[model samples]
Target: MKRYLLSLRLFWTTALSAQLEYRFNFLIELIAMLGTLLGSVFILSLFFSHGNKIGDWTWEAALVVQGVYTLLDGITNTFLKPNLSEIVNYVREGTLDFVLLKPIDSQFWLSTRTISPSGLPEICLGFSLIIWSSNRVSNGIHFDHIAIFIISLFCAIIILYSFWFLIASTTIWFVKTWNATEVLRAVLASGRYPVAAYPPSLRLFFTLVLPVAFLTTVPAQMILGNINLLKLFTSLLFSIIFFNLSRYFWKFALRFYTSASS
Candidate 1:
């Protein structure tokens, strides 16, 4: 474990050095991201100006949900978005053969192929929002709630990564599978708010079929003391099942591969 972590650190160092070569571009991108975040905060402010509660969530709770959404966004940008997109290109150009020949786990290599340090500011902003909201909550938060929220959020991240991987791996069989990732981005957008805010049918769809419930709502609700044991267990169950399924499916996809040289 230590050796793997050391090697991973080395990979991060190399990636960071490469990205720093374009320091001006990196700064510009960072500024643009900050502007987008401010816009999102402004919209949320208008939302809360109308009412204290939206579907049993107080304004602070809602803010926490938005923070979770930000964290999810940062995660997608930092890892999944760039690498998963490349996975499709690898398939289309038949360059995945180069990835397969690497000595390490291909998925791990693929996942860490690029790192977006710019996303770290967004992640920090997300945590800062959570802390601000928790401080303002009338009932106050307990350590247990925070602990559960951490676990639940980790599960949500795993579930989301697996779901995206499931979609991306389809490229092994269907070369055009890359475009489907845009649809995934749309679906995950629904997770920006509490799932309960949607109509009953949409709520059921997000909760059961797509996992937006586990992705955003459950973690925020857990932090706010609004979640139950069943919700926690179900989130864990979904994450474990999907993570295993994506792993196995990745192996399944490899069976269909043919080299670019062919």
Candidate 2:
């Protein structure tokens, strides 16, 4: 465990140095990220202005959902996406062999090799929105509600990580997992709205199957003090199941990874 922690520190140190060396490019990327986020919120507001509420959710609730979604998305993009994305290239170019040769956990190393400090701005913006929205509520939020929101947020991240890991592991067979990642992104983006806004089938899929409901809606609901113990347990179960499945798939993929140069 200590050795793994050391490797993670080394990895971050190298990544930070590399990012510093390209500070100008990093700044440009950060600007682009902020633009995209603002653009998304603007579009949503425009749509909401056309109609009072989308389904049963008010504009304020929608904004809260968007804020939470953005924060979680920032976290994923900052850490997991930047690193897990390289899995396809590693498998295709035989670089994975070098990773495997290391005495540490290959999955851990592969998943943490890169970090995006540029994502901090988006995370900050999202957090600000969340706080602002919480204060905007007519009735104030309680400590217990805040605790549940935090727990739900943590569980949401785990669900997202497991889902992405499962999709990225497909690279071992598909060799072109980029499209898969795109599909996952599109599907996960739907979590920005209340799942109740979707059709029955879609809601069921998000809640029980893909489990994107736990990503943003559940956390938002927790803040609203609408969460039930049963649902929380269900989310926990889904996280554990998906995480184990992803780990198993990654191991299974290893057996089939014939280095590209081999």
Candidate 3:
């Protein structure tokens, strides 16, 4: 465990150093992130412009959902996209052999080999929005609520990573899964709005099928002091299931791997 921790530090430090070399890119990313966030808020405002509440969610509450989505999206950009997207290329080019040969776990090495600071601003802004909006709706943040929110948010992140890795693992059989990843992204985009805002059919689909509700809405609700133990338990259960499924799928896929030398 200590060795792995040391390795993680080295991996991120190296990645951060490399990213810093192109410092101007950070400014570009920050500007783009701000523009996107503002545009999202503008569109959200249009829904409540005429005193229309989305489902039972007030504007502030809805912003909490958006904040959670943004936070997850930032994580995707920072970690999942940079690392998981390379799985397909590694498979196609036979580079995965090198990865598998490493003393560390291949999944660990692949998933945490690099860090992108471009999404750091988005992450910071997401947390700020979540706190600001959540406080407006409920009494100022409670320690208990914050603790529960952190737990739910951690589950959400695990679920998100599992979904991505599940898709990425298919590279063992299908060398190009880019379209699948895009479809997942499109589906996940719906998470920016409260799940209740969706039609019944879509809401059920998002909750049971894709589990998008757990990704954003549930966490938002938790932070807003609407803590539902059942929902939180469900989220925790789903995260564990998804994560294990992804891990198992990767091992299964590796059984079929044929190195370039072969």
**Candidate lDDT (C-alpha), each:** 0.84, 0.83, 0.89
> 85-154, model 3: which lDDT tens digit per residue?
9888889889898889889999898899988865666687789889988988986999999999999999
Candidate 3 runs further than 4 Å off: 23-51
Identify the runs in model 2 with alpha carbons over 4 angstroms from their true place: 47-51
Ranking of candidates on TM-score, top first: 1, 3, 2
Lowest lDDT 10-mer window, candidate 3? 43-52
For model 2, residues 1-262, the per-residue Cα lDDT tens digits are: 8888888899999998998898798788878887867875686577457656757777777677877888887898789888988989998888888999988778888889989775676688778777777656536778998898898888898899989988999898889889889899999999888898899999999988889899998888778777698878887888888888988989998998878865
Ranking by lDDT: 3, 1, 2
Model 1, 20-77: lDDT tens digits are: 8898987897788888678767877886787567687777778888889988888888
RMSD of each: 1.7, 1.8, 1.9
| Per-residue lDDT value at 13 in model 3 | 96
Q: In each prediction, how many residue pairs overlap at the backbone (N, C-alpha, C within less than 3 A)?
A: 0, 0, 0
Q: Name the 10 consecutive residues with the lowest summed lDDT in model 2.
A: 43-52
Which stretches of model 1 miss by more than 4 angstroms?
none
